[model samples]
Target: MKLIAKWVLSASALLFVAYVYNGVEVRSFATAMGAALVIGLLNAVVRPVLVVLTLPVTVLTLGLFLFVINALMFWAASALLDGFVVRSFLAALIGSLLYTAIGMVIDSALERLLVKK
Candidate 1:
């Protein structure tokens, strides 16, 4: 149930990102959902490998490199999907930041809601 809720909320967050950021474009709710799933999968699978491989740079940057990884994942999702588009690397960076912020809010709300029950 929690997973389902997170997926839906993540999709909504994607839509919100598109609405607020002109550089990111999502055609519809379904496209946003698909993009969300791709982003989640990339984060779950590719992200760890990237973190490990880029450990030195990540350390050198004082953990700031993770933001670049996040942006790459976001841009990769846009590349893989048809209806979801990120205009450029800069767009991807900003969009990823907005998406991450919204996701953090969703996770926090979910944690509070579920823990109280």
Candidate 2:
């Protein structure tokens, strides 16, 4: 149930990024759903390995490197999905930033709402 909620949050964030970030657009609910799945998978698989591999840089940067990893994962998901196209590196970076920001917001909001209920 928590996992489902997490995915929904991710989907919502991706949808927002598509709307506000750049040329990226999720044409339908199905496309957004698919993009969410890919994003989750990439975060599950690629993100950990990336974090481990870049642990030194991550530590050196005072945890800021995680943002880069997050952005890379976002770009990877965009690359793997259809109907979701980031126009350039800058767009991808902004999209990635928005993805993280919105996801964090959604998660915290859900936590606040559900924990009280």
Candidate 3:
């Protein structure tokens, strides 16, 4: 259930990005679903590798480098899907930051509205 909630949160984040940023492009639900799959896969598969590879730098950055890994996953997802496009690394970085913010917001709201019930 938590996993499904997370996926829905991520899809909502993608939709929000599509709406707010000119640099983000979502062609259709098919593409969006593909992009979301890739994004989730990359985060799950690549992120731990990246975190270990950059462990020293991550420690140096006081653990904030996780955000960089997250951004790279977003950029990679953009590359994999034509409809879901991020214009550049910087845009991807910003989009990822936005994703975190939106996901947290959605999670909190879900907890309040659903779990409280």
Separately for all candidates shown, the number of backbone clashes (residues 3 or more apart, or on different chains) is 0, 0, 0
Q: In model 3, where is the ten-residue run with the lowest total lDDT?
A: 3-12
Ranking by lDDT: 1, 3, 2
Instruction: Give the TM-score (vs. native) of candidate 2.
Output: 0.85
Clashing pairs in 2: none
- Model 2 misplacement above 4 A: none
Per-residue alpha-carbon lDDT of candidate 3 for residues 2-108, written as tens digits (9 for 90 to 100): 77766766786788788888777778766766777788899789888899999999999999888888889999999877778898888888888887788779878
Q: Which residue pairs clash in candidate 1?
A: none
Q: What are the runs in model 1 whose C-alpha is more than 4 Å off?
A: none
Candidate 3 Cα errors over 4 Å, as ranges: 1-5
* Order by TM-score, highest first: 1, 2, 3
Query: Could you tell me the TM-score of candidate 1?
Result: 0.99
The clash number for model 2 is 0
Q: Which run of 10 residues does model 1 get worst, by summed lDDT?
A: 28-37
Better of 1 and 3 by TM-score: 1
In the range 1-117, model 1's lDDT, one tens digit per residue, is 999999999999999999999999999999998999999999999999999999999999999999999999999999999999999999999999999999999999999999999
